[model samples]
Target: MGSATAQALVASSSALNAAQGITLDVAGELFSVGRLIGESTALSGALADPAAPAEARTSLVSRVFAGASAPVQDVLRAAVAERWSSAADLVDGVEELAVRATAIAAPDADIEGELFSVSRLVAGNADLELALGSRLGDGEGKAALVQRLVGASLNPATTLIVTSLVRQPRERRVRRLLNRAMRIVSAQRDRIVATVHTAAPLSAEQRSRLGAVLTGRYGRQIALNEVIDASVVGGLRVQVADDVIDGSIAARLADLRQKLAG
Candidate 1:
């Protein structure tokens, strides 16, 4: 992220935080605005143009998002009023705000965990991933497919988030979109996500201890997204962002085999 975009994100996030009585409706409106802006290069450029007056950008937001609720409009105005490094960054900024809004509205739901699960599902199913992420498919079809597949099991907030993203992926792969949403949701809660792969699910106490250890080391709250992979054989493989801690028996055997062969 560029310096300007980072500053703009903080500003927009603050504006979202200040809004009272945030609801799923607010998140829907923000997503609608983000999608419209992302689809129009001209609009995004005009809004994010550094030379343009901030007043002009905010006025454009009012004209374009007139149908949005007051809170949504307020957040958009705040976003356009700041300087972004690029037009695409402006669109991403709005999308982040929308994701954060969804996280806020669903305070009781495990947004990161649910999104991670969706990502795993997509990663494991090639046909399903192609169907959802293919550019040739109509947005409505993708949205309906998403609803039919996971809507029943997901929280209302999660269903709304998944449906909205599948409808307008904007060239992101399904896994990429899901992971990005999970990252934003984790950041919104002031936590980081650690994906743990093990032969079996971790016990609640094990999970707590792992989270505490990671939090102490990283100096931030840690949210674990556990995956049960039988191929792990034993032990755990944990990843946070780019860093990996691989202790799985499969990895150890592979290392030992490579050493003996050399």
Candidate 2:
């Protein structure tokens, strides 16, 4: 949620626009870097520090990503050099560039990962989600937080995906932004984003059955994202895009108890 994060993502998008013929693996690696930077306050703070020697920060980036592609390295250096409003802003610029490159690198794989990550962001926290998705905060603030989150992950594709989100209208909430993003990604690649939350991971058989049920009901092919949520207790919560099918035992018991009390 720092300003540098936003600038990083925006810078990332610009980098991706300049990138050509990047590979899927490269895109994934870049996204990982962006996410790492975004999520870790220490790392972002170090990089965003004006007093910190540019050489030192750049050197750190190089050492960390020595084995990465030349393009990715360039993107990282460029992002750090850019004068982001805050550490969070740094993340935004870098991530934007990364995702665009990833979309070009591996359309199918990148779209899935982007949707999954964005949705996960929505599911992560309430205050952050609201702040990023609210009109009360300016684009600069939103961009910063998004950048940090995506920057740590460092996928060119992830960056590109996040950049688009950062550019949307201010009225959208984080969850809505994620949903809209999932739809765009799905449409681009002819896939569906089905977010499934459960007490534990679904078995292969369960996934298959659930996939079939969702596909039949929605009339679209889906890529299932299984999110393990221990708080759900004994039941499963299946979210096929916007539609939530929660059949958790805890919910049922609570419902029954409430009715009895009533």
Candidate 3:
């Protein structure tokens, strides 16, 4: 994220955090507003234009989202009031706020885990990914497919986020969108997600020990998203942001091959 966008997101996040009575319904409404803005370059541009008067920009938000709840309107105003790096960044800022709001509303739900599962599901199915990620796909149809696929298996908050994202991907691939949502949810809880790949599932005790070690190293809670990958051969490959801990046998074998070649 650019500095301007980062600052804008921080401001918008504060607005969301301070708002009272935030609910899943409010989160849905925020996503609706984001979808509308994402679909219109002109609208997003007008809102993000640095030359435009702040009052005018926020007034547009009020006029357009008059039906939104007070908190939604407040967040919208706060978003447009900032100087975004780009129109797209403004749209992203709003989406992040909506995700944060969902995380806030569903305090007890395992939203991060649900989003990771959905990410894996999309990554594993080319047709499903294409259906949801392709620009040519019908937005309504994509949303319906999401509802049918997830049904009641996921938390209501997760369902809302997935359906909203597929309805208006705004050129983001499905996996990217899902990953971003997971990251936002993790951030909401002051934690970071560690994507761990292993030859087999980690036992509960193993997972607990790994999580504790990572938490201590990072000085923050660590949420693990475990992936069972046969290619890993043995051991674990863990990624937290840009840092990768590659102790997997596959990586070791590759290193050995490189050394032999040298």
Candidate 4:
């Protein structure tokens, strides 16, 4: 979140956006490098250490990611050329770039929806979430589990994002990782994600009107991912980024109870 990390991410994002052909391969390679750095404290530290010479860092990238594709090596070189806020931030930046590259490769894919579905799936299954997010478990095992569960049904971008997250969670929960990935995918499409929770599913007309209203309010097209939550009672709860518009009766009752008690 520091200036250096932000600047590095922006530069890397532009590079990914400008490149064409072999993007999917680039994404895979970046994900692999990110995972490697994320799991290795020493390697990450060596790359992000400001005291070290830039050439040394670049050389380290060349040595470590030497087998990666030329495009991937180029990305790593660009990434290491800049200073990072922390070792962790370096890993995060690489992972974010990987996700962005994947999104760019599959411009027409509904990656946000697929990510949301995976988040909900993990949230609903505590054992599965624990298994995948367990720090004690093998990263490859978790990745294999994701592959087996998703099979070929998911979009390639979705699969890559999920696999990368499962492998290098970096102390994040599965749900948080998926939400972040969803936001990244949404930004790639020049849209924002709105999670709408309602007692029942909205009709097509209702969905259209809701989307229109949200777009007007947010000044951007909204992608609605509807969730049927009976706890919402008679109304809806919508979340856009960090903002929550809770019109649900459940929220109202809770607010009223707190006010009356006070």
Q: lDDT at 3 for candidate 3?
A: 95
What is the C-alpha lDDT profile of model 2 across 8-119, one tens digit per residue?
A: 5555556655765577666666666777777688988887788877788888789877888887887787777655668766765454454455556765555665666676
Model 1, range 75-153, lDDT digits (tens) per residue? 9999999999999999989988999999999998988888888888999999999999899979889989988999898
Give the lDDT of residue 39 in candidate 3.
Answer: 87
TM-score of each candidate structure, all chains considered together:
0.94, 0.48, 0.95, 0.89
lDDT of 3 at 23: 98
* C-alpha root-mean-square deviation, candidate 1: 1.5
Model 3 error, position 196 (Å): 0.9
Model 3 poorest ten-residue lDDT run: 130-139
**lDDT score for candidate 3 against the true structure:** 0.93
Best by lDDT: 3
Q: Give me the runs in candidate 2 sitting further than 4 Å from their true place.
A: 1-105, 110-113, 122-145, 152-154, 258-262
Q: Write down the TM-score for model 4.
A: 0.89
Model 2 alpha-carbon miss at residue 112, Å: 4.1
Which parts of model 1 have CA positions greater than 4 angstroms off? 258-262
Scored against the true structure, residue 18 in model 2 reaches a CA lDDT of: 75
lDDT of each: 0.92, 0.68, 0.93, 0.88
lDDT tens digits, residues 1-262, model 4? 9998988888777776766564777788889889888879999999999999989999999998888888887778788888899999999888888888888888888899889988899999999999988888887889899999984889887998898888878789999999988888788678999999999989999999999999999999898999999999978999987899999999999999999999
Error of 4 at 20 (Å): 3.0
